[model samples]
Target chain A: MVKAAQRMYYGKALAKLAERKEIVVLDADLGGSTRTSDFAKVAPERFIQIGIAEQNMIGVASGLAAAGKTVFASTFAVFATGRCWEQIRQAVAYPKLNVKIVATHCGISVGGDGASHQALEDIAIMRALPNMIVISPADANEAYAATMAIADLKGPCYMRMGRADFPLITSEGVKFEIGKAAVLRNGNDVTLIGTGQMVMSCIEAAGILEQNGISAEVINVSTIKPLDSETILASVSKTKCVVTAEEHSIIGGLGSAVAECLSENRPTPQIRVGVKDSFGESGDPGELMKKYGLTTDDVIKAAENVIGKKGKK
Target chain B: MGGAKGLDVKDLRRRADKIRMHVIEMTSEAGSGHPGGSLSSADLFAVLYFHVLRHDPKDPEWEGRDKFVLSKGHVAPVLYAALAESGYFPVDELLTLRKIGSRLQGHPVKGKPPGVEMSTGSLGQGLSMSCGLALAAKLDKKDTRVYCLLGDGELQSGQNWEAMMLASHYDLNNLTIFIDRNHLQIMGSTEKTMSIDPLAYKLRAFGLRVISIDGHDIKKIIKACEKARSSSSPTAIILNTVKGKGVSFMENNADFHGRSCKPDEKEKALKELTERMSSW
Candidate 1:
């Protein structure tokens, strides 16, 4: 397992992206947290700090793409997806412009800033738009790799990350693809599909379930929009029971995407583990994750419930 | 320089008049379009397509092509006429202005229409997109320029100011914006609806090179485009124009802001515009 650093993982990812010549980073005044400050310091021309204007920032990124410049517009997930949604839809997605939107402080993990800063519904908002590729990297290594991969891609993409430090699950050598799912464990009793920070929680839950003698397979689905349906369907068809986890809301996020896939392709008993229909409040990241039922224990409980339902059937 | 100096001003003025006539006729056929703004912007559109903009209609996506965005997208009739006449599409397709499934949507849709840089209809957003295009050009060290035409009424939207702030901050000398100050929106006169009178001062304060001109004067519009290209900072031209300039009774009338001309009204409007063309 890759080791978790003290600073936010997104910051490290941005720093690594700055090294590439093709990558151009843009920030709408939230440079301090989104970790674009490091890129600005190193390569000033490559970094654009469009202070406090999310709409203009998105437009600038789109323009850069038109001139054959690969641009990454970074901001809080709330502002990037919510405030500037129309700009994203018109300038980037509809035109099929190649602009990478990196949204940090995603989900409730953006602790103490309250519900406004925490973007629980960003996934739903972005995924609904046509021609948009939605991705949530599990850790710093994955974020770095995803950032690099998306820079080379030729269309609009949304990259979601967290404000706080997250556990680094995979090492540098692990191959990362845009629309493919990553399988972490092998089991047949039930399948657990998770994304973003929740992938780590699923890894922990898989270990816990093994102790209880319930074999569980865990899949880390990074790209939420163009979901790897074949992998997900194959796992659920064999297991016949599933537990989906994400830091996003149960509505239209990773869990919803998984359910949509399963209901259509392969019908399976499923339990979705995420924030119930509610808002997040001020607290530590760990406390908020636990309170919102986004912990490893929550996943274990959700998995057990799905398995129990299967036994009853 | 020799090509521009030797160009026939009379022929260009005739072309602008033809575009205005088409703008009225097509809007009348569609039964819905902003003729007031479209007629007001006729000269500027004519100058850009005929002289100022460096583009090949055959190769719309050419890497070094200069970009133009109609921020005042309600005036799409003028743009469509220019694009169609410039050989981007068949000139006969002008009658299909707002027809269902036509490439020419009510607002500009990029990729559907050659020479269209971005899909723009929502007000105050085009300037932002233009800034992006200009900034990209600057980054790539490409000499290509970006011109955006904004409605005076659209200045009421806050996003335009956001774009203004960034354009000045970046010193995007490659970007130029034209404000079609026709003084009429859908409701009434711009002052009564939403005042943007001190438009030049606002643009100047935002650090752009501001030029106020007679919008319908093709020569003045051409000179302003040339001046904007020569300016060190990003430029903003306020084209003081009367809404529906050539058509009698519709001139300076707010009712024509988006109302289609009746069958009889279309004949009268066309006759008036053709007569106005004879004077040039």
Candidate 2:
């Protein structure tokens, strides 16, 4: 099967949801890029094109939410989270408005747009805001299900998606619950947790680890903020070591979230494989991932390193 | 629709003066609040809450009621005064302006007060939210109008301009934006700090129905509001007003923008407005 873009899945999900619910989709002049144009096509009256104004989009979404409309604000991750940080903080998060900020083209995968467009810190920024539910789907299937899940939950939510088209790891009938981690392939040597676009690589990394006599349990943590700590702790307590992978800055992405949970809860030795604390350059997505030490081999190496440190201390 | 209820200009003038008096007393009690900007927009708020706004004083959350947003949230004293006078809360509660336990927060918080529409302490955000409310009303096929009062100093934030453009672009005719052209910022004049000269032209260029009026004149404010309601585009009512409008010592004074009036200052200020009430 061909890979699907999570952003396209996001747009299709909104368009489908509009058929039943009174959904309002807002875009900051990136409807085509973010794939929200799909929603605009289906329901033009419900779609608001705000013309490159990210802050206004967020504030407007809050107002719509206050008026009892399920509002989905779409833009690139950088502008959706960073440019309109205060608006999301004061208007939406502080008020706990039922507004969904679903941003696409996250991380270095934005490719040629370079560091300016890459949103390496979006997860961290949104996660820090109170009353904000941050979710990063692993693939297009999870992205669709997650989009539907956020609509059902009333409150401020931030759903992050990548620009690249990735093959689906989760099949149909798989339950996608927020704050619940999905353990795809179970093993006992070490636990590998990944989020957003990195979970696909984690599965492949587990494949490589299996060849090396390392049995790895692959867990997909879609919801990063209200993290599935119980599921993660259960797996880590069994494996005694963990590997966290994400296509985001290593400082405050999935790795940081898992580290924060384990360092305080279980104290498991872990290896975090992600973008270093630096800006991304303009390059092909795959090339940039290899250059930034975010690949299948990187995750495999990280799993081995953590497995090696399982009983040393 | 809003009913005049046989209330003449005399009544509105008295109400405006009373609002100003409350602003002065509230700020004086708070010990650190914006009196100048509050006083400047008191007349606008008086006319809005008392006469023009289609709201039920008893039902502050009436879904059909017109929405008002104080985008220049620093001048929350006047909003509290108007809300108090309109029976949204106790008139005596105006003295608890900045008290920790009081619902009357330093800035206008939506749920904090009955009539307050939304929380807007940071400048340049209220208009966008107003536009959103107006847009939602349009989507619902309701004629609920939205009024947002902005301080000239708050226009320095770029987000206001972005909202201004979208309000015009989307043809948010249900939204009426009033810029309190008080000229004075907390530090100095708006021109000296960040020159937003050619203000009318800037708003007109954004395709709004621009109406410039004396912010202190109850009659002109009414007329401008009428013109605003009739326009097909979003209306920008530019109010030419003094920072400290009613008080003799505070008018056009930048120092009075954020400072509380001393006891002596409050006494003189109250006496000035109280004298205007006897004729009623």
Candidate 3:
């Protein structure tokens, strides 16, 4: 059975933490859509609904964090990361405050609402900021675990979540740690690195490649800012090739992160499979993913091309 | 040193004059700083650091201490001067404004200065931060109030209005907002550019108790601050001030908004404020 969206699990995590007595959740009037309303139900007094003002919401979250409250500021990814980018930089990131900006409805999976609502560049923008930790969980379970994990970690963080239901990939009690890669499936022909919703596709692509006897290693990169270079380098050094899949832009998303890591340490042949410098259009999420070159088929094809570049049997 | 019930008006005036002189010298030394806005807000800064705020200069992170957010952070020279003069740091450190590796950065950075409460440089964010702080203070059941200073130009940013609504909606009685109505921004007069005229009505409409005051008057500024503390709702004190308060050449001069005074202009400004310092 498919689980709820990552945002649903985020809200559930906060509800579970309601007894902790220090967690304060804020939303930019999009609580219902972002699923932060779940926390509002459990801890109404602790939840602050700042109406339609993303900038003020971020600043207020920073203030609460400064005053010793673990603050979670949530909204749609476009408004949370793009509209209030400067506010996040000035008030939250600069101070290195313990504020988690968990933005939902990220990427083309926020389908039919069109490009204006999709946050294809959040990873790049957030990672560029000093003292900002960017994370994109693979599924609902990881998002839930990441929410709990982020509360314990210090410093400003940007967590991106998607709109649609994600297939359950991780079993219960799978440990979640910031800046660490989870080796989902181990193999040797090529490394399949993915983040957010695309990790499911990378897993499927690895399975298909295994059927073809290509033996693709699958790694889920939940943390984007501090790219898990050690795991990617080790995997790529053994595989000698990589195919990075993400639901964001190919320009600066997980693909670019993997490429940057491999170029410095492993020097492996890499293929970046994502939205290639284009905006998403209104369509079904499945069709949009295929249109944007973020499908499992695309990752499998990228794996073949990259392995071919290695010039190995 | 700040153990007095309230600072005597004359002593506060002398301190304000000294602060104004320091603003001139520091901005002149920096060679590129906002002297006009700093000069305008010097009196209010004087009254706050010396009289109004409940802070320990030594224990800058005192939980019970009242917080101040320089919403109009370009006028950081005045805040820096007050912090130094109040012994939060060395008085001589005022001369190092905007220099490489100086704690006195071009804008008010909270951690760098012992008493600077929030980092502010980008306009229209401090009021929101103030509301957050005030809400927290109320949650902790402390009498600690938050004071945020906003510029006339900064009021144009829509985020300030958003913060205003939040403060009012939350009934953040512990927050006091001061708007420095200096009429001039770097571009030109606020009226010629984006006008914030009839600001009293706008502030009241936004659900704040508005109090108009002569910003340069130490006694009046102090009185309004007292009233803000006693108010049941969050207060917005409108400080009707000249762009450049103490200096003759710079007063109401848009040219002096962000640019530091030239050597001759700096000498003239110091000469005028130095004489007033002796009398006050």
Candidate 4:
């Protein structure tokens, strides 16, 4: 399978979006790694090099948005969400400014950078802010589509992407809509929900579950904040049990969102596959994913666990 | 309120006094708010609202109007007063400061009133946002100017230095920042808390055209703004001001920095401001 990093496609999208006169891109000294360097190359004048100040980068983005420019601020996920969360809350989300905070190098898979660089809590914190739309694309194609979609939308958004290349699950030129989840596969025994890179794991988990005479529904929950409760409830209602997978903490990520939704609508037996209240260490991406229980086998086991809980109930 | 004519120093002075009176009234009426910094920056706000800023109270969202960001947003009573007295809203609404459901939040909110440019209270952020506004104006080829007011105590936040570096790097000629050097923070004096002294030279070293002035001098504030606009880079005006300028009892008092006046103190403050108004 040909794999692609979501950040590369985000850069491609920025390069294409450079022609829009109102689009202003800002990067905090990591343009090359975050792929905003591509936008800088095309629209040198529109691209602002913020030089390692993530807080100032967000404030500048807010100001630009206030003046009627659609601003895109890019940085590593740790710096993008954690380093300057208050700036986004006050300047961007509070005023409902049109700033798209696109962060790369999210999750434990940002290998070798260790815990400080990995942003397992980006989804949690960004989701907590009012008027902030949180999105985590499943693959490169969806990342590109999400980048374009957020630019057209007129409010503050936080969209995260992973660092390493992953299998291309969605086809090229995939369409993305805010607050909408896509159903990748359908079944009745159990529902497997995932977001960001973990969506790939869920798809693979579904494949293995099918071979074992177990039916598993696979869902790609791209927008984590405005969770697509309708699609989620529909799948859970039919399957009666659900498993959520994400390359983030089990606390306040996609699993929490799904749990919150299901508990209110239809309480179902569920298991979460993610990092368990622990920080990551420097290692290879594959090994780190395995160590953190973010692999396809982990998702498969979670699905089975939830299905077992369902039978017991 | 003359924009094209000679500077109305007397009218602006009276406006500053009236703004100070409103600050006292609003905070006292609400029983809590920032008054010391607000009193210090009244003259600058008066001059900006009455003369310097090209803003219409009727159309705050007009594309051509110059933008203002109060980075030291705890002093929002002054901004609300300036906006109200300038006819952005009814003057009576100024009395509702910090009350539940009042549009006049203890800190400024962007969308609540038409004139408030950005929601700000967290320090060191307004300058960066001002840089963004200035950059956006330049990119659009609009001659819009951006103004930001910061607190001296706020310089302790590392983000302000980052914004200063950025504003200088981009050569944001259309941006002007005012530092309300009232010398006090919530705890105590800024110098004792964290020395941002040798501040003018430091700002100049950061690539800004630095101007130091008595913040209470309406004429000097206006002139400094004009001089700032003539420069080819971002200008920073350090306004040397007493913590509480107009009211005698509150002058240089750190307690007034975050406190409203009691009944006796409010009466005295109003009388002092009114006496000054009559003298002007």
Candidate with maximal DockQ: 4
Worst 10 residues of 2 chain A by lDDT: A167-176
Worst 10 residues of 3 chain A by lDDT: A166-175
Return the number of clashes found in candidate 1.
1
lDDT (0-100) at residue B2 of candidate 2?
Answer: 37
Q: What level of docking quality does candidate 1 show?
A: medium
lDDT of 1 by residue, A78-188 (tens): 999999999899888988988988888888878999998999999998999999999988887888778778877899999898887777898865567999998899899
Residue-wise C-alpha lDDT for candidate 2, range A1-313, written one tens digit per residue: 5688999888888888878546899998899988889988888999998988899998898788877789999999999999999999888998788899999989888899899999999998899999999999999988999988998998999999999998887775456788888898999999999998789888999998888888999999999989999999999878999999988988888899899999999899999988889999899999999999988999988887888797785
In model 4, pairs of residues that clash are none
* DockQ of all models, two decimals each: 0.75, 0.69, 0.75, 0.91
User: Which pairs clash (backbone N, Cα, C closer than 3 Å) in model 2?
Assistant: none
If scored against the real structure, what TM-score would every candidate get?
0.95, 0.96, 0.98, 0.98
Q: Which tens-of-lDDT digit does each residue in B232-257 have in candidate 1?
A: 99999999988888887889899998
Give the residue spans of candidate 4 off by over 4 A.
A311-313
- Cα lDDT, all candidates: 0.86, 0.89, 0.89, 0.93
User: lDDT tens string, model 4, A1-313?
Assistant: 9899999999999999999989999999899999999999999999998998999999999999999999999999999999999999989999999999999999999999899999999999999999999999999999999999998999999999999998999999889999999999999999999999899999989999999999999999999989999999999889999999999999999999999999999999999999999999999999999999999999998888888888574
Ranking by lDDT: 4, 3, 2, 1
Off by over 4 Å in 2: A311-313, B1-4
Interface root mean square deviation of every model, in Å?
Answer: 1.1, 0.9, 0.8, 0.5
Model 3 segments beyond 4 Å from truth?
A: A311-313, B1-3
Q: What is the lDDT of candidate 4?
A: 0.93
**Order of the predicted models by TM-score, top scorer first:** 4, 3, 2, 1
